[model samples]
Target: MGKTPLHLAVTGPSSVVASWILEKDLGLIRIEDVLGRTPLHYCASAANFDLLLKQGASVNHVDKRGMAALHGVCYLGASDLVACLLKWKPRLDLRDKTYGTPLHCGVISGSIDVVMALVEKGAPLNAADANGNTAVHVAAKLGRHNILRLLIQQGADISLQNTNGRDPEAIALDAAGNVGILSILKHKRQDSPESQSILNIVDEDTKASSLDNQVTGNDSPDFLWDEDSMGAAEQNELMGLSQSANDDLYTYEEQQEYCSTTFPKPAPESQSNNGFGKAAFCLPR
Candidate 1:
């Protein structure tokens, strides 16, 4: 019986529908369903919050769960959306009923990009929920190794204890299948963190060990060659006929661009400052 035209407008398959529906009654913009979710909530979850902000959608209204429309913005991993919502200056630190801040939502969404956005926007890194669990705690418990590392790098207070008196590292140890997370935590105690070596060739006797596992291991698929199809004198690297073996795998040099951070800096937000469901998206954008 409800969703009113305004609720549907919030869905915004196109801005035209929202604008046209609003022409009939501007009041629809503030309408809420039985769930207490407003058009702005849907707008934050779907359409451009910038477009909605300009359209006069209320950003403060929370649904039954006490989550502001800004919380829903985490559902979208797009940096553009992050930039738009940051402009609104919504309470970046607002908590949902569970006390989970926007950072927690982004972490739950498992979108590394989204997590970076919140961190850059000055969202609380150590804010705890009703359970005394912080985003770092959640990252470690969930085996989000990369996210956990970034949080710690940003000074998330790995020593912070939850209600149970367990720090993020302790939480990581308690959570099963978190060996990788545990290892990263352990490195923080060491004076020098050791990075895995890429590749290098020594003497001819040890040359075979330098190749990739695929090339040297027995599990590699059979490499077929039509010996008769080619002249015996021609180059036959696969056949191993050449006197000098050219190492194909490890001999190649890495060509990736050098960069300090992954996710591009979060828009115009300050350098110092800084999802929604089981997946990065809870509902269709």
Candidate 2:
């Protein structure tokens, strides 16, 4: 029994000696085996599409998965191989069983060349997959900001919502993509500068309140200073001074003695409970 041509091509090499064996000695290998690609599938998956194509591989051949060689190239976003496949004019609109066309695969890969090549080749841009996700949706979900921008420019619906009720901004935020998307959205709304100015005013008010609290030794509700912070040490010194300022705790007689010794005041005309005078004490004769 002759070995199948696919088996020979897969195991055989592109070397002159091996080619002679398959071509001259065997004569069993068919052109279809080389084009149908039992070998190209393995090569393309391994990113060896260049070698397979050089070894007389067909660009239009579909694997068992219903994916053409071009589809594989698009998945890898290999511009060179994609260009070669485009040159061959393979069926660009060919979709797999899941309605995943080459254009779908190209967008998922997020390569400009792959997408542009498919678009140029007349691949339908608005087609959605089983999940009703257009290429723009996929790009947004993956947080491919530039790719999303490109799709938008190409008439992709930025407002289109997926089945989960999420729009592009929500998806990008969920994915934590670059803050550039947030800035873009803010710019579109034209309210970013106003919001920023309001925030600055609030922040300045907070700072002013904090400074007043520091000068008055009053702890602001918002400014909780940790015991280990330098601010706490400074606060403790101020609190000590405040504690010394509480003169109401001293006795009235002790205060009068303190005042007399400290200030050498003149004797009062009479010691009495006069409402107009400071409390006085009679000294012992």
Top TM-score: which candidate number? Answer: 1
Tens digit per residue, CA lDDT, model 2, 31-100: 3332243434433222234444555666666644356756666766767768766766778766553325
The segments of candidate 1 whose C-alpha lies over 4 angstroms from its true place after superposition are 44-48, 75-79, 190-285
Q: Model 1: which ten-residue window has the lowest total lDDT?
A: 250-259
Residue clash pairs of candidate 2: none
User: Can you give the TM-score per candidate against the true fold?
Assistant: 0.63, 0.47
Tens digits of per-residue lDDT for model 1, 120-225:
8788899986556788878887788788888889888776765555566655554653667767766764565555211221224343232222132333211111
TM match of model 1 to true structure: 0.63
Clashes of 2: 0
